[model samples]
Target: MTDFDLPEEFDEENIVSKTSIKRDMHKLQALGKRLTELKPNQLEKVPMSETLRKAIDESQRITQREATRRHMQYIGKLMRAEDAEAIQNAVDLFDASSKAFAQALHSLERWRDRLIEGGNETLSEYIHDNPNADIQHLRQLVRNAKKDLKNEKNTGASKKLFRYLRTIDDMDNETTP
Candidate 1:
């Protein structure tokens, strides 16, 4: 049949644009890069075909820039035949359960700010929640943070306070079942 010939089985709506295909390829490539960055154990947790897994493993060994790029493209090509969403979900789940550094950092900062702003009331509440915390140390940090507030140049005290809060937070997480 000619290019314009009528075909009852053909649906124009099912056709994907070139841009869309390129976008998907780029997304798969980016995902492949993330897979390459994962540790061996973490890589194992991701659901992927054996061929795709082998491609990712090979990618890790290629240190040369251009070669690594080409190998990553190959990995991306291989991923086209695998369940990308399942693989992505596995990676995301692992990441969410990990340290979640940014979320934890923001939380610690908020606590530090509240401790400084909320005065003794907040500090008392914090101590109540974390009974094992060194009250004297926590109090000293708050006091130092308050002192540092007057001088913007001195951020050391607030940083120390953040660290102390993070330590307590981490310990609590570890103790929790």
Candidate 2:
């Protein structure tokens, strides 16, 4: 057909440029890399599909550079089918710096210290507040933490105690809504 008789041009808004597509691919890859960097427990808190989780877990075992790169590309591919924003929000929850996160940490630390100092009294109080908590496990951690405090050594008991408290807090958060 002649130029004057040609059909109208396609809508520009509907077209995705190659540059934006590549940029998004790279962004997803970067997010996947962040996922791989997270600790196992932290990763568990993130909402992701089983297949994507398996790919990420497998990526950790890949030591060679080329293999890791290929696996990451696969992860980026998988990420395209997932809700990137939700995953990012879940991952962000594990990080520090925000006032809420700091407050939660301080609260857990206070509970740990109270359990160590007040012995059974504090244990009973905590159990009353967190009925769903593993009482026996928390009791054991408190005992170990107290022993560690007396010895003035960093044997990780205190850390374990803090972690246990945080776990209970996370559980409560999940159950409330």
Candidate 3:
């Protein structure tokens, strides 16, 4: 038989080749590196085996480059024995949520800047977008923020505006299905 030919019992589709195994190990190591970069709270959301978690924690503590690389390889080995798919899904979800949060924060910042710079026109547009928003409170905060900017104060009003935007964001999240 040729080198490419398989035995009757060996299903090519079901059998993992050496190259595929190596590729999968590299993918797992990449995921492990991503997990190690996460903050403690963010890492908590990703479901992982206890051993894998310990390995990741150890990897984080290691300062030496070669040692960290070896530890990451060990993590990849442990990952090979666990449910890599599920772990990957959890990490993807976390990444998506964080990205959404960043987008929302940027949107809020844009709105705040518009309120301070664009004056009545931008305020009207904002009110049109958020009908349930407290017009009086928003106007007050915007006025204070603009005044603080003009007078070169500590910009406490800007911080208050940010907090108000965050509350609105929280309310919107709660109301969404």
Candidate 4:
């Protein structure tokens, strides 16, 4: 069997053309002009990886296959096993954390809605029966209930509870005298 040999395209020597000495000077002059024209923001752009720039620069003078192999080699050295493991752990934590938070928020909203509903129902019943009640007192209780109801839909419970609490408070004040 014949030995497995890579194609000439993958060989660096097959790709790089020796620059004529006179042309090399011209290339350097053009590179200098391009560098001077770069804006400050353009200069500040950070590379994804420092070696990426070197790999791209090398590609211009080498076979595409050789350039890719060199880039992969550079990247392999830059990545650490520990950092990869840590990133995986962080991603897992974010997923679990967000799910737990959403569930907790849903549970809390249900609890608040129940309280407001019950309060509304009781308050409404009390106000209906006590027509002669102090207008100021009744108004205060209703205003507070209105605010809560705005946050939640008005239901029997919220009306009843608000009226009930106010009626009880008013009765206690009247009895004290």
How many residue pairs clash (N, CA or C atoms closer than 3 angstroms) in each of the candidate models, in the order given? 0, 0, 0, 25
User: Candidate 4 — which residues are off by over 4 angstroms?
Assistant: 1-97, 120-177
Error of 2 at 91 (Å): 0.7
For model 3, the superposed segments whose C-alpha errors exceed 4 Å read 1-6, 96-177
For model 1, how does the per-residue alpha-carbon lDDT over 2-35 read when each residue is reduced to its tens digit? 9889788989889999999999999999988888
Rate residue 122 of model 1 by lDDT. 94
* TM-score rank order: 2, 3, 1, 4
Q: Write the per-residue lDDT of candidate 4 for residues 41-122, one digit (tens) a residue.
A: 3322322233433433443455587655554444334432124333233222223355544554454345334444456564
TM-score computed on alpha carbons, candidate 3: 0.52
- Among the numbered candidates, top lDDT falls to 2
Q: Model 2, 31: alpha-carbon shift in Å? A: 0.7
TM-score: which candidate is best?
2
Report model 4's TM-score to 2 decimal places: 0.19
lDDT winner between 1 and 2, please give it. Answer: 2
Q: What is the TM-score of each candidate against the true structure?
A: 0.51, 0.58, 0.52, 0.19
Candidate 2 has what TM-score?
0.58
* Cα lDDT, all candidates: 0.82, 0.87, 0.82, 0.44
Candidate 3 residue pairs in backbone clash: none
Model 3 C-alpha lDDT per residue in residues 1-177, reported as the tens digit of each score: 999887889766787889998898899999988889888866776677889989888887899989988888888888888888777765664575666556777889988888898879899998887776799999999999999999999769999998897777656544542
Number of clashing residue pairs, candidate 4: 25
Report the error of model 2 at residue 169, Å. 3.4
